[model samples]
Target: MGTRKTKAPPPAALGRAGTEKDLPDHFKNYRHVWVFIELERGEVHPVSFELLGEGRRLADQLGVQLAGVVLGPPGDSTRRAVAEAFAYDADLVYLVEKPLLTDYRNESFTKALTDLVNTYKPEILLLGATTLGRDLAGSVATTLLTGLTADCTGLDVDADGSLAATRPTFGGSLLCTIYTLNCRPQMATVRPRVMRMPQRSNKPIGRVIRHDLRMLEDEIVTKVVGFLSDGQSENANLAYADVVVAGGLGLGAADNLQLLKNLAQTIGGDYGCSRPLVQKGWMAADRQIGQTGKTIRPKLYIAAGISGAVQHRVGVEGADLIVAINTDPNAPIFDFANIGVVADAVSFLPALTEVFIRRLAPGNHIRLVN
Candidate 1:
């Protein structure tokens, strides 16, 4: 079940021209929307593609160019990232290559990106809010002395061509939109899965603005010691699941979580809980779903006994469908839920799990024809 948007985003001047009365004139010439295309060891993180999808929209709204910025070592790794960027809707790619950038170092990356922004100014810059992205964005923003909004869930352009970065605030108590009114190259960071991935096309890359990184390996303070990969774990994957079943305080007891688990396992989905569940020791921190936890955009979400607070709402707002089951018809979850069931989850969850088990039994496969 997918939840509907119960409330629209807060409005403001909605345009830079309206809000930039006192803005410095020196920052006015910046143009184009740029997304940092992250590449490591010949692989590109999916979040970069997601940001390209979002950046494309802002670029269209502003009637400006959408470019992907790639900082990596020269070779197949960097070239692949640039090619994929074009396929994901980037009009052009900004390629800055150097041996020192072969691995992600806060100092080298920060210097390289900041130099690029200063040299060929862009109006807006976007980066994925991952480990490497967060570190690099912070350093670059600090160096450029521009305003930066982090962990943004939404991005848009206003009438006067400003980056409107929307993210949850006050510990996810509410949503807020922030703008860099007087700053050049407004910056923002978005977590993985927060934005939808764009469809890939055969459209070839138009142009590549190649730049040189003025740095030496010895100047970099931190060094990559070794490369180690963690074994695959379920907790790390709750955000990307196609289906998710989550329990909340409405369950009344920890044992009740089994009902949600049963339903998820039967459907080959993942199970999670609200923030309170983690505080109460009913679930692990990794299993919590919300702004402070993992942001999910599953195809279908089943929230049982969850109150659907603003914080939790921001995380799941991207789900294709949301089904809420709770006894309180007046709960906030009901306002946004696509399908609301008024019943005690403690009793109803078990019954629903039983029904699904029977219907999905082996040899009873459901099929659809296009």
Candidate 2:
């Protein structure tokens, strides 16, 4: 038998220089970087701040201003979102407040954001890959007739000043970088927890460019009948958890998941699985962790029986500590994990659980026999 060799993907082509001589006359006027501050039900999504942190880096690289675009009804929530944007290091903010914009309607938000982009002409635009952000980004990009990359995991500026957006492709087997060479505003959407949150400060509010939305309420087709919220108890909230324990196919049987849950319960953490377990119908989709699922930044991550492919690695690389346990010493998980153990996860998990129970149980202490 012969081992199969995989072909490597070709390198991405470089984009044109960002100089005035290289860009089209119309695109030449585009300047600065803008991140849409997604506000829903009177609260700003944390993904907005994450994008701002990334936008700040791109802006510094391009030597341009970093701005936040806020569109919502005039209220305390809107005002607070603007202030928070400034605190997150936005050089300025573009405000569009109207009663019609109270609830996010695709028609209203698309009009407001497209109008802002047309008027101010930013060179780069970023949005969170949330439900609201996805709807608005698609509509705005379509209306503006520009290229838009969805669910990007990595974003950067090329030497030629093009927006380099990297995302998983071919069912998360490979990553490819995309560029909008001729587009005026290079647009991309990033999922929550994919980028690190920026440090915020109590800086005074900076320059705000207010723009009035001209569209009337009756002109919009979509109406908000009422708001229905999901059950809070059912929510996974996996991305924000302090500690996480995950398992993969090497666990051998679906029944073994209880080991993962037991460990997670012992540590006061959350438990999840890789994409395969979800595909196998052994785990819920929300419990899947990978490029196509939740991206986490937990303080500690324990991956048992996982091979640690690039897709899985990208999702948990933000963890402060990673401990991998697998029977195969050559498992890819060992390459990046902070600690690696070569052992059968089925047997190791129960022993690890017992050790924790002995050490962490209240008023339980064992004398050492040195």
The RMSD of every model to the true structure, in order and in angstroms, is 5.2, 4.8
Query: 1-370, model 1: which lDDT tens digit per residue?
Result: 3322324433544454355575577877889999999887678988999999999999998888999999998888898899999999999998898888898999988988999899889999999988789899989998999989999988887776777888877657767777788888999999989998889999887899999888888888899999876446544578889999999999999988888888898888898999999999999887789888888899899999999987788788889999999889999998888999999998998888887777778765563111
The model with the greatest lDDT is 2
| Model 1, backbone clash pairs (residues 3+ apart or across chains), number | 5
What lDDT tens digits, residue by residue, belong to model 2 across residues 247-365? 99989899999999999989889999999999999999988888878888999999999999878987898899999999999999999999999999999999998888887777654
RMSD of 1: 5.2
The true-versus-predicted C-alpha distance at residue 15 of model 2, in Å, is 10
Q: Which stretches of candidate 1 lie over 4 Å from their true place?
A: 1-19, 22-25, 40-42, 226-230, 252-258, 344-347, 362-370
Query: Which residue pairs collide, candidate 1?
Result: 1-321, 1-322, 2-321, 2-322, 3-322
Candidate 2 lDDT: 0.89
**TM-score, every prediction:** 0.85, 0.87
